[model samples]
Target chain A: MSIDDKNVILEIDGLQTYFYSSEGVAKAVDGASFSLSKGKVLGVVGESGCGKSVTAQSVMRLVPSPPGKIVGGRIMFDGKDLTKLSMAEMRHVRGDRISMIFQEPMTSLNPVFTIGDQLSEMFMLHRGMSRKDALDASVEMLARVQIPAPRARAREYPHQLSGGMRQRAMIAMALSCEPEILIADEPTTALDVTVQAQILDLIIKLKEDFGTAVEMITHDLGVIAETADSVVVMYAGRVVEQADTVELFENTLHPYTRGLLDSTPILGRRTAGKFEKLNEIKGMVPSLYSLPKGCKFQERCPKAMPICSEREPQLTEINDSHAVRCWLHIPH
Target chain B: MGPRERPQFTTMASYILRRVLQGLLVLLAVSFVCFCLFRYTGDPVLMLAGKYATQEEREMVRHAYGLDQPTHIQYIKFLGGALKGEFGKSYVSQVDALDTILERFPATFELALVAILISFAVGVGMGIVVSIWPKGCVSRILMSGSLLGISIPTFLTGILLVMLCSVYLEILPAFGRGDTVQLGPWRTGLLTLDGLKHIILPALTLSSYQLAVMMRLTRAGMREVMGEEYIKTAWAKGLSPAKVILKHALRNVLIPVVTIAGLSFGELIAFSIVTETIFQWPGMGNLLLTSIFETDQPIIVTYIMLTSCIILFINILVDLLYAVLNPKIRYN
Candidate 1:
């Protein structure tokens, strides 16, 4: 999609995050590029080990060093390249201009601290609010996330709250500063199905209320359908396809994206009064340490051409609002 | 999310009561072992009356000390006296054995406290430093130096310190507790300059091994905690690295480290025998050694019982600390 430059709050161009271990250097995110517009939800869909989470971590500058490093990337935000910002400068941007929530709410909150103490820490650190004022703000923020009896819940520890409640508390803490961009990295993946829907709704509602852009990373396309306006499909650390959610689903171009859609179980779709066998893409993901020179998806693509084994396909635009990476889509 | 009904107070109280009861049972078992040592180790009457005493006089001494009574009767009398805080007389000095040990306890307690405080401060500080900059030269040196601390024997460490600080340098005293200040019933070497100088060597000696252990534990714990989801959340919240390490990672690291520290403190108190002998410090270890050499059964029994008591008490303290450090640990 042609995103208006002024409306794009965060733009990631050619991001490369690699993990160096005793075995070898694993390119976790190679050439990932996407832009998040203001007050809109952008879904990042991929299977496990597809670099979706790493891309998010890179944006937050939270990648663990030594083993993991963002070797290349230009994360342009607010007229500055975030990747080049010093740690001190980045600290100001994080949680103030951009905030992130994680998948495992159960473990994402500090266990030793009370919910209020942890949430108030955000205000204390960035806003320089007094402890008492920060705590009051924490209670208000908790209430905004629809946590019942926010005042009492604030005094409780992470262990005392249910999974859903803890996720809400996490959301409350992330949104407390009213950040311009919110990154939810599979925010509801670890919760119950019912709670997942609630958390997603809460995020969407809060995003609208605060006019904050959101980058929602998850493997579940259903979540994208429910909350995302646009979707980015990633495979083997590369963005293979990008388009508006409805347009991409209606006219999916990438073979890998087609496989993902076919694999998902649909409601009320039966054959001979029995559920049909679900489709699954063939072959495991290529080892990141020793990826083949051709398309990363060549081994698994049902429609792979001989050229797919010779040259890696670059992301190519098929139309004004749709892009795909495949030999079929590219004029070669 | 409504007010979580916390019955924590009652559970906590009952938990403490149960632990106390268990402690009493352990003490009872220890007392039985001590009583066995008193009965079977040697004839106290023979030692007290000496080779020069007449047979009739020896019999008279045995009768006076309840040694002539049957084992069960003697045990009952011993148990009764123990309940009233009496532990018979020391064969060497003819003073109350319990009183003698209690008098020496202050010296050992003071030494142990100083040793643990020093070890904890320096060890944990080093651990934080190394964890933050695992590859820095300073961190590498500290880590390697900690290896030496762990490898060296306590007595050897004591002797080395004595040779360096006492024999070679001659700036600090190497032996004895020096001039002590009496505070109520407790005698301490902490308030006076001479006393402080005198304690430096022995305390350093006593702390070396514990310091190494604490350093390693904190380093590993901090490293592991830095990888936790919560720590990443802390960073994403726009917190400085210092704040994230100190507030988020350190608290979690302390959970396991505190348990070890508590146990290590007890160990320092019980096993400072070699250091005490090397430095001629007037601590319980010295008293216990002297009693063992002189075959002062009463003092030996009392010492063993007291050491067991301290260990058990520390265990309870560690358990309580776990509740403090991690809210997931309910007292119940």
Candidate 2:
């Protein structure tokens, strides 16, 4: 349960990111806490609006202000609280120490810039590399990511490349600086399945080669199962469960986590030539603007208890390697 | 690489050729409409001859100008003359119509260029400021003020500017392109200090609406691009906010802005009539207005054709710019 402070490159504690609109304040990421160990993949899994992306944004301190603000959080990275860092100080950490790739590779790289130009920017901005030197480094990075004819592809724009190639370019850019942490926020969600596999493999391979820590965010449990060392399951802006990937999959504690696991259709699971219906969780994620006072997942929990309706359960450690937020796990 | 390069070059060359052909077709259609409209407006012979003149004198004038010919014959003659770059002489001035319009064109071109440049610089700058700080008091004022720019008539704006700057302050020149210097065939006010002073009010008046449009477009575009995943990636890469916005977000925003700006530039040149009249700028707009009132068929037809040609050329330039700003856009 205790992680060495030295081993953890980024530790996010009690992070609360809220969005204020004319309608109401939506708690996008409410008190989400997790740590990303150095040179390991920490998967954050949740459905849309569950705040996994918001949590990642909060860590980067890239949340849009006014509409969205980080009300409170201690994003401890490199002996400094990121939330407390000045914009100027944050600039030093971003892309140089911590880099993030997004779900959309197509839109993530700038359309107007050549792949080399965009990749070279990281070098020029952070290392003060000259344009020519940065471009040379960009070609090397592209080649490192296995982009064929890297020099030629460097001259081309994002649109000239295929989806997988763009994602490779993104990975190449993100790893160009060999940052301490890389945040992959559902990085393969926008890609085709075959390309998705290739992109995921490329990310994993690059992580090994560079020894970079990764916060792999996705809604797909299969991706977490394959690539994550640990998993954080979020529901309605709250971290409902956290554990080692194998432990969480085997001993799913939170009812929401159980529901999520059940909903994922197993490959080749058919009964007597008839396809069995996938077990979907009974209800949609509670609206963030008007979340109930009780547990966010109470309405959808198959084994909802009376206590679940009265108060929300905190994420409590059930074992050395597992934590769950459910009245069922807590001893009365 | 050689084979690929050859095909791409051919595709681009063919694309340009196709666009130019389409432009020619549009010109032909426009010329036909102009010829028909001018022919039916009134009898040029009546206008040419005095009221006391005999019918024989009117007939002689009509014959002299070839106005007595059949409509089809006249149209063919007109087309043939236009193709030969000889649109005949203005009835009133007895000057070659094409030469007169061409002489006036530089004045209009100079004014439009100044106005568009001013609008582009200020508009895009304000847009960036407001988008970055949407809730700031300054941004709110700018947003509200831009509404006035959009709502007020161009002539009224010109008149108001004249009243405030010319009548009230009496600091700047009220009217006329002050002290234009002849540059070969082109007369340009841009080369002289007094001409530059005279241009301020009219250029400001002409630019107000376009500036408002560019501002709003840039603000919206920047806001949208700010939400893009790549921008987040840029920020996460430890780039300064300036670099993230100017380099990453602005480039993408400019793709659409360039399109609107190009079209607006064409419009500014064609539609500076009201501004020119108020300021007595002696641009194409002023020439066109006089020709229309005097029913100068040759000048009117030539002006229409020239304006259409300029618009077509600008549109082609805009398309080429699109390909430059966004690599995804290919004519083929």
Model 2 clashes, total count? 5
In angstroms, the error of model 1 at B169 is 1.0
**Residue-wise lDDT of candidate 1 within B62-133, one digit each (tens)?**
988988889999888877887887888998898999899999998899899999999998999999999888
- On lDDT, the candidate that comes out on top is 1
User: Which 10-residue span in candidate 2 chain B carries the lowest summed lDDT?
Assistant: B323-332
lDDT, candidate 2, equals: 0.89
All candidates: TM-score = 0.97, 0.93
Candidate 2 local lDDT, B188-207, one digit each (tens): 88889998998999999999
Model 1 residue runs over 4 Å out of place are A271-275, B1-6
| DockQ scores of the candidates | 0.73, 0.73
Clashes of 1: 0
Model 2 chain A: ten consecutive residues of lowest lDDT: A267-276
For residue A139, model 1's alpha carbon misses the true position, in angstroms, by 0.3
Query: Least accurate stretch of 10 residues (summed lDDT) in model 1 chain B?
Result: B1-10
